[model samples]
Target chain A: MSDQEILRTTGLTMRFGGVTAVNNVNFSIDHEGELRCLLGPNGAGKSTFFKCLTGQLVPTEGTITFMGEPIAGMDTHEIVNLGIGIKTQVPNLFNGLSAYDNVRLAAKRKHLKRQAIEKTFDMLSNCGIENLKGSEVGLLSHGQRQLIELAMVLAAEPTLVLLDEPAAGMTGEERDRLAFLVKEVTKTASVIVVEHDMAFIKQIAKNVTVFHRGEIFAEDDVKKIMKNKSVQEIYLGKSADAA
Target chain B: MEKSILKDPGLYVMVSIGLLIMIFLPIMMDMFAIMQITQYVVLSVYALSLAYIWGYGGILSFGQSCFFGLGAYTFAVASINMGSTSLPFILAIIIPALFGVLLGYFMFYGRLSDVYLGVVTLVVTLIFWKLINHTAGPQYAIGDARLGGFNGIPSIPILNMPTANGQMMDPIQMFVTFMAILIMVYVGLRLLIASEFGRVSISIRENEVRSSLLGYDVRRHKVVVFSIGCGIAGMSGAMWATYQTFIDPNAFSLEMSAKALVWVMAGGVGTLAGPIIAVVILQWISLKLGQLNIINNFVLLGLILVPLVLILPKGLLPTVKQWSQDLWTIWKKNKANEGDTIIKESETVNAGRRK
Candidate 1:
């Protein structure tokens, strides 16, 4: 696909109980079929920014345009309909529902016919979580739940996916698998990943936006953002070994 | 422990026996008494309605009695005025469904949460009961069929099958008439739940947030399910009017609503069979208690409900399914143990022959 701006936000700001969590941040990402990482230290407003973009919260002052249509006032459901999907840091699968049913719920939104269900079954196979189909999401291991969540978002056939700490609670092998899955999703949809893991970021992110305080400290390729002195101080801290 | 006998076929045979009893029940009893049984069957309609919304749509409408009352009163008044019972009967069911649509619009679009929705329905039911009870008087007559208000509309003509000479039919004919309506309503309900709309209702109950994210108009689904559930309840109400030939504000009181809720909760919220099994079992017990001349009906209700809750919190059907599965596993384990013993005995005999 040709590069284009699928989602754009201007002057995005969020305040909760008089504390400014996210300041006016002007940001846009062009559809480059590549993973873009939003990196920040603790309390850098990374998650807040993602939430605003995904319509989970109405920004105090900002206009979010998705696919060239204003979506700031849209509800979370409407935003999902507008082709933006989100995978939360926590495995937000319905505990009582089987893994297949969880993904089937999302898939039904796209095409709920019998053929569509078969297609969803295929997607599950691709994610290597097909055997867990009959298992309740609550019963699944952490790594397995992540796979189910990915399958669910994919089932919606979203044009853009906002992954908040997709590999937050995973072993090295699990994180690598998640990195591979994120890269694979890029072939079909633009992926925005918010993560602090340097190795995972380097593995998937083609472009990186480094956040500090409540603003973007740097936006560039992985190598430049990783070596930036301010980025090092904010994320890696003063110790050289932190790098 | 033969595996074939432990299979689903045996379970299906049990269900068939239940169905046979249901079909033959009225024939064995006096038709006048059967008409009384029809009242409970009508209540089953309301219970099933509650099941669809509370069990499938995840709405515990404490005001379901409101729709039941609305339908009963509408039919009673219309039948009295028009001097035609059928017209009022049809109107009764339709009006309540429309009422449900309007109520659903406000409750759902207002973004009212579950607990508030229950309160709103409860408040509405109480308000209607109070209004109707206070106003019912002797002068409240529609074409000579008196709307007794608190005394209730009484002696409304039981529907008669008219012949060419305008011959009026008897009570047995009325029972047959209501039975037809009951069967049709029951089948309609089954088909409705099997449709795409039914699936959406179940989905909403499972997860409203997820359903919305999947692009379903959650408010629309809620309204539709609410209307359908209320409509079924209204049909039952119409049936009640036909059988009793009398309806008062008491018919729509909080007590009735509470009983219906108890029935649905004890039966199982999500399962279709829950309400049916609950109705037959609970109503049978209530009937037997009534025979003993018990003034404390509430005590009888508590006796059945408390045990159902304590033993089968997930509802009767889920509990039964779990127990059956456990039994099958135990049987299979015993059979495997016996097979192992026989195999070891055969091997020892072969060793003796070799020696």
Candidate 2:
């Protein structure tokens, strides 16, 4: 992992109607292969921040630079074209298509016809659902669909990946598997994961950023973040007892 | 998943049956019947355009007759001025396609939702209907072709061969020509839907936001597909002019657009054979109903469409395809179970003999 900033957001703020979803804040990813976890409560503005990064919503005030270019107003497709991948909270797979087809569709955008087919199989196997290639995505279990969505994002071979609550509806075993998968992904790309599960975060994240009331409450290593008094009171909500 | 023509037994069977009917109908029937069949063939082409956009592209255009009527008028005006069918034919296709490009750019790029798209298109069709109906005065003439308004332009020139004297095509030649065009369009559409572009278009239809996140320009794809559909509709309109030897403002009416939609809905939206089959059967029934004096044909059409929508919401062809596939799976499972039982019995018998 090299010391190069892949993405940076300066003084980002997003307002919907009269409510401020994400207050002005500066965030940056300096290492190429670092796994950063975003921990926040519901409505902590983590989703809004993720959306701003992915170009789903333009921030009302701020400048987001990706790979040294301003991307605050770029379209979602344009952002993806710049080698950034996003997996929203919702498993937005094509329900009528098979698992293979879902990944194949994403692969086709960045690869040739023959290479797309090969990459699709490779990613599906990597995600541990190669046997379910022929099954429709709608027929798959929640964990299986989540894994497929991850495979689809990986198939594009992006340099940066953003995932929002990928383990929200998974079993304990599934979360363990997801932790391994996220670790494996960071070997090739920088990753920003928005999650609320403390155990899952401890397993996957080395660097943690806690958010509260649309602001960054704390930022540090997992051990220190869990030990911090303010983070425990505002985010963990139990002080030392929760720790 | 494999897109080989041979893999779809239904398509092969339908095409074969349709070809046989096209070949033998003229020999078995009178000239008037052949002419009516020719009209149905042209209408089938129009229905195909709707299916391409609505079924495959997920664009439910309500004013498709705008393109069709534009094609008819372009053919009439060009043919009257040049006294040749060749240039008019080319213009008929090109004019509507250009118009489609213009309309689609605004609608798709403007990010109009499906419901808004339907409303805008329907309003455009009504505008065309009103605009053309009021062009009945003698001043509305374009060169030698008069805009006959509600009465329509009569004695329009038929399609002619490109030879020196430009011999006019008779009813038989026209029927064969229209059938050939219909087949070509069907085969072309089938190949397109099987291509990579077609797969991406379907993905966009399934989920536009997901497709965009996957790096697809959803707006551009929609606009291109819309333009192609409009061009095809224009071709059908040109054929309509040649077949009837007359052009009318009714071609631009709401009824014409509604009928095209009905054909697609009654047949099946996505499959090529669905709309073609639906148009032929329904038109035949409509002609039969027309012979009776008691009931209006449109009312009878409404009656048939209501039941069809209720019973086969996915349309006839897709539902039938699903049923056949389900049956095939059940049969395969049953055969596997039978084989397992037979093998188990044989093993037990061998053990008993050894004991």
Native contacts kept, each candidate: 0.42, 0.73
* lDDT per residue as tens, model 2, A79-113: 98998998889888999989999998888878999
Instruction: Give the top-scoring candidate (lDDT).
Output: 2
What would the DockQ be for model 1?
0.39
With candidate 1 superimposed using the best TM-score fit, by how many Å does residue A157's alpha carbon deviate from the native? 2.3
Q: Which tens-of-lDDT digit does each residue in B1-355 have in candidate 2?
A: 4567558776577667767877888789899889888999999999999999898999999999999999998998889889989989989999999899999999998889689999999998888888889899899999888887898888878999666478998898788778878888887887788776887788888888889889888888999899999999999999999888898888988889998898899888887888988998988999899999679998987898898999999888898888999999999999999999999999999999999
DockQ scores of the candidates = 0.39, 0.66
| Candidate 1 positional error at A15, Å | 6.3
Report the Cα lDDT for residue A83, model 1: 91
Q: Kindly report which residue stretches of model 2 are placed more than 4 angstroms away from their true locations once superposed.
A: A13-20, A23-25, A58-61, A112-115, A211-218, A227-243, B5-15, B163-165, B325-355
| Cα TM-score of candidate 2 | 0.90
Q: lDDT scores for all predictions?
A: 0.78, 0.88
Q: Candidate 1's fnat?
A: 0.42
Query: What are the models' TM-scores?
Result: 0.85, 0.90
